[model samples]
Target: MTTPRLEGRIAVITGGASGIGQAVAQRFAEEGADILLTDLAPCDATVALVQGLGRKAHQMRMDATSEADCDRMVEMAVQVFGRIDVAVFSAGVKTLPEAPRPGVDPAKATQLVHMSVENFRKVIDVNVTGVMLGSRAVARQMLAQGTGGAIVNIASTAGRIPLAGGGSYCVSKAGVIMLTKVMALELAQTGIRVNAVGPGYTSTPMWDAPEDSDAYRRAMSITPMQRNGTPREQADACLYLACDESSFMTGQTLHPAGGQFTG
Candidate 1:
């Protein structure tokens, strides 16, 4: 009999309420991993899904932007499963649309810069700072355990290429990419590998606008595949990074953007 890929492993996932996070929890559970799911929203549904798959599951409400929450999440995982073998940092905020103004030309819409400072900071707080906190907390625990582990961050194609009206989100994700490299380099000696996955126009609530919405149309235009990626596809990339198949890989960013762009 063949052994399951993640058998006996304990996985921690943030933003596990829905979309890519929920999909990852399911995929990891199917691979036989016990899961600790956390999100700003209730993650009970994802927990139930994992339990149904015959794996141990636990859910906790966590605000990814809070340092205390990030620390608590790691402690909870250890309390429940004794150790964390993999962690996927997927909690993030979507790019907010620029507000409509009277008499503004639609032709130069992309050139308009009306984004607020508060909005920019909020996105960074959750995406960049949140990942930093999660990685730090998990790395500390893994170092104590002295067992190699994996850290997978969820970046976006927007991080590779600047998109109009996506200034804050783009910058935040770019920060995540660089942070992954730095984390990988620092933790290499400790046996903890760090990597990132960049998904392009994924099918998630973040882009839940109507198909005819400008955002959706814009995403479709730049994607070479002419379609948004599925959450499961993004989850598959996470699974690969979390598993031992990519043992020799670290400080890398895997672009699952359907030929949209490579970097």
Candidate 2:
């Protein structure tokens, strides 16, 4: 029951401003890891949260899809923390049925089939390419450090099974799962591990219509747990997969999926 499993390690978490990403940063800090959190905009709030937990941390703005941004974020973490033992790709955007923004909602404003091609490409780029860039960038530094490390990508159960309204999101997550396997193979020589977390119906603010979202509730109903999982539970799973406790594990997906995906 030692709480400091990650004492002295440095971890960089992207998309740490909200949802599962935020939870992971907080939990990692609690485990004694010095952290760096980045998001599309400023990560000030996440920075404050981690520091409030009595751990050292810094925040940066990053767009994971940009190689330059990803590299910069990793470089800053290494410079500040001296090394990067872990990198977690947890930033993602979703496409809900009732999205109000023209870019987000397909059916709104009678734009179902009329949605911009740019919007679809944006979702795929951020969700899939973003994970790849972050993982690869941090891995290079880890290889140079030559101590080996871990990388965790946040994927969804939607990738495992499917969600009716999660068009591009589902595709993007599926790509993430595959990318993990590929990266794991390529990085094995360095003792670096690559893995993914497939979250079930998680009870996070990211679930568009929270209390009354029928589509979200419908996803939960199929779970054997019969309820949504909390961010902390999923965060713990991410922590386990990120730590040496899972030393024998690599190139696989750890599902905190509430029995939702029998596969």
Best by the lDDT measure: 1
Error of 2 at 66 (Å): 1.2
Off by over 4 Å in 2: 1-3, 96-115
Runs in model 1 deviating more than 4 A are: 97-112
User: Among these predicted structures, which one has the highest TM-score?
Assistant: 1
| lDDT (10s digit) by residue, model 1, range 1-263 | 87777999999999999899999999999999999999989998998999999999999899988989999999999998999999999999976544565766654333426665677888889999999999889999999999989999998888889877678889999999999999999998889999999898888888775788886788777877878789999999999999999999999999888788631
Total residue pair clashes for candidate 1: 0
lDDT of 1: 0.89
RMSD of each: 2.2, 3.1
lDDT of 2 by residue, 1-263 (tens): 67587888999999898889899999999999889999986778778888999999899888888999999998899789899999889998875334365455444432335444666688889999999889999999999999999999999887866655466678788999999999999988889999999888787767644656777568767788767888888899999999999998889988897887563
lDDT values, one for every candidate:
0.89, 0.84
